[model samples]
Target: MLTSESRRRDFPTLDGRAYLNTAAEGVPPLAVGEALAQYFRDKQLGMDGRVPHAAQWEAARALTAEFLGLTAAEIGICSCSSEAYNLAALALQLQPGDEVICTDLDFPASSTPWLQPACPATLRLWKHRSGALHVEDLIPLLSPRTRLVNVSLVSFYNGFTVALPPIVEAVRKHSPALLGVDVTQAIGRIPLDLRGADLIVSSTHKWILASHGGGLVGVPKDRAKEWTAPAGGWFNLEDAFGPGSFEAVKSKPGAASFMVGMPNYPALYAVRAGLEYLRGVGVANIDAHARPLVLHCLTELRKLPVEVLTPDEPDHIAGILAFKHPKAAEINARLHAGNVHVMNPTGRLRVAVHGYNTHDDIERLLRELKAALAAV
Candidate 1:
């Protein structure tokens, strides 16, 4: 039940503009900015006398865990989504004969790591079914040799929220391949539980609305023990001194082992602020507030000549609504001129809604979009 008025003043950009670009780069509120400033100031206080506080890092990670319905042990702080993906790719230890299936609709960060030479895994890029991701399409691609399946929980191009529960059930029943999700597009915007998946990764920038360079990877504590990938920073090990020799080191337990170096203090503080704000506002309430706005936009957008790429079904709808037109990029450019900020992701126009947005923002976007489309 957190309204725009309660949080609008926290975001400077929301003064008189429609910022429907949370998918690309979330606008950090004044709290996050102040936290960032305060972090550097405190860091300078110690000068050469202090180390990064591990306890603060854990608190921030716990905030993320609660937001995602995961445990702290399952969360491994990462510098970015690419880093998280890299850790997952290494942990899988795929070989020449091993096969990994990924959907073409996912962002490159989710698919490229498994395709690296180190893994040497056969890559299968499953095509979308009827312009959307479907379990039926992915099921046919899985086989016994499939060691992993990479997918985006939500599509960045079309704003399609991939229904994960059914897909996970089918994959586990049919193939030995483990499921991995890139949650960059859907984490804070939707409800996510990591109970059934093998692993999941996310950057704090998008839906969590935090520092851009911060990320985390989630894996069960037992799975973390069996991981083969060696993230080589000294701090990643539990015993860096190694009793007498550095060779005797072992990685810290669970996802924390994935932290290769010192965590960025500034980003960590920003994450704490962002996560605290979300906790106060409530993720469920945010989802309820945003979904109606997106559905309203989708319903009204269909009246225009543009082709809506995102599915209208309840299973597929998310905070994002993407539309395609011959002059999509031009229309978005004009919308920007009119102070309506939407994304031109490739050729599609994507409007992203978040907790801080108001119904009036979407109304202005529609009015501006109508004018922009006509002008284009």
Candidate 2:
């Protein structure tokens, strides 16, 4: 088991202020930063031309695959989750009048691609009453023409963790729809079994502790061949640099076909280091240590005048705790003024606790929050 003190050493930013905003962007560990800096220095020294770029990119892909419990061939390196969503939308073969079901609470990245006016697709929006979309509510929205059901594994604002297995089963049973997930919030903070999802998209910046501009897309093994590559670049070809390779050969199979261009190598190298760090700490153990801090925040916040929005059940919660006080903006301003940081999603305050956070940090946050409220 990794100790909190040792984990805290990994994040140098923890020395300055309380960082309770992993949901917005995680603090990359010193190792990842050093790896990225080394890559930058190597490039500056003109060693990038001598390095085996393909081998390094392939290794990065393999590391990401192992982290998500998928085959390397099933994972595609993307610039962001939004790009991954666009790839999934193009590959789904949606016909005219086909319906794409998504929730109102979904981040715009997951919904906007399907809403393109020229796409010849219909949008079915699921309503959220309490910042959550239950499976029962989704079932009523499903129709025979529904071709896809897209949702986030954990909501960005409220941190309501969806029960994905049952939702996948429900979608599969109700319609011949492809089930897609935006797992940006859930990837490193929670344990995910990717078998149930037909398509999964995530960014490495949050929770994974990677540099920005790196993302991942996971496609199911059985349905891999059904996806057609609409956006093609050199990296998507089997022999990208081979003689006459530009003659437009058949698209490579699986998630590799989704690759459009040369990936951000330095960002990927940093992501690889972050994945190695996550492996050393054990994602399950990280969740075990982090979840308690989230629960502690919830428990303590409930005692105050704040309205706790994140669910109390551990099974249905991620590392985020969201709440709203009557003077939420004022309280958040006060907290920030005191050198304590939290996320303000629109109006609600989101507190994301990660492995680097200690119980003392949570206590300090609670103290500051109470003081902020009193001042307000």
Candidate 3:
């Protein structure tokens, strides 16, 4: 039910500018601003407003659970994707001789926890061939000594959507390792069925159209019995304020254990509003709206001198696209000065198309890009 015209008003920052940088950080809609203001009004009440603020956190948790196709009990809240990864690594308790597999194309946060000096697990990299990861390449890396396999559903450098189900099956057939997936780039932009993985983490800032602070983590029902958070706090206790509040710490079971402190309630208010907006305009509808923009941009970029890094196949791509350019830094600055926004990270230009973008935005980008390439 979402159309480019209908959602354009939600983002007022697009006042005569092309925004192709959702992969880095999203522009929050007007509704998110109102939610933050409401949080401040509630904060004026001091101790009396605690119930309502806690309600906002619960609402965001339930909505996130629905978006990822999991139960409320399976979901937990964190500060960001890095905190979620660190919490998961602490819970894993990998010992010496155990190996953890990470892709060479993965973001550093995905593998850094396993590489800490105190971590007993050995870190291994599954190198990507031709800027893409294959299932067969990952199969050989799995063994009985493997404790975990970490990967992102979509690459941050280039929009190469990995086939996760095959990798899940391979892990089950090969070893007893737990499969952990970072869905920061995949959650709100694409249609996802994440129940197959053991651990899933995502941040709400990018495709979710919200501010940062609410990081989501999910664990399937089968693993809840065995999963327990290693750290505890007042938030993790059963009777946080009631009688026996400080007597003996009794940790809450399941995903709630990950909430070791007072959550970022202000940002969670924005997450609640953002998730509500996505529900109003279905995620599938957003995906359908973005494919044509990606196709249009890709078709025009092929005529340019840059080498396209995103796959052309329909199944392996989503809203993001990347291309290699020698003078990418200079070109990126030119585009920004011309009011055309994009990212040039590590010598690759990344173009991220979202629901609010229209054909006019693509045309502006192509026009500015053509001029920038010629001058550089």
Q: What clash count goes with each model?
A: 0, 0, 0
Ranking by lDDT: 3, 2, 1
Task: Residues 1-376, candidate 3: write the lDDT tens digits.
Answer: 2555555678767868999999999887899999999999999999877888999988988998998888888888888888888878777877899999999868777889988999999998888777788889989888999988888898887888888889989989998888888888887788898757888888889988888887888877787644556676768557778777667666666577778799889988999998898888888988888888888898899899999887776677888899988899999999999999999898989999988888888999999999999999
Cα lDDT of model 1 by residue, 56-172, tens digit? 587888987786667887777778888877877766767788898988888888888776666788899878865688788788888999988878888887888877788888788
**lDDT at 103, model 3:** 91
Best by TM-score: 3
Off by over 4 Å in 1: 47-52, 226-228, 243-248
Ten residues in sequence with the least summed lDDT for candidate 2: 47-56
Model 2 misplaced regions, further than 4 Å: 1-4, 44-52, 239-249
Better of 1 and 3 by lDDT: 3
Please write out the lDDT profile of model 2 over residues 155-176, one tens digit for every residue.
8878888887788888988888
Listed in order, each prediction's TM-score against the native is 0.94, 0.93, 0.95
| Alpha-carbon runs more than 4 Å astray in model 3 | 1-5, 239-250
Please provide the root mean square deviation of candidate 1 (C-alpha atoms, Å).
Answer: 1.9
User: Using TM-score as the measure, what is the rank order of every candidate, best first?
Assistant: 3, 1, 2
Model 1 TM-score is: 0.94
Tell me model 2's lDDT, rounded to 2 decimals: 0.81
* Model 3 lDDT, full chain set: 0.85
Candidate 3: 10-residue stretch with minimal lDDT: 1-10
Better of 1 and 2 by lDDT: 2
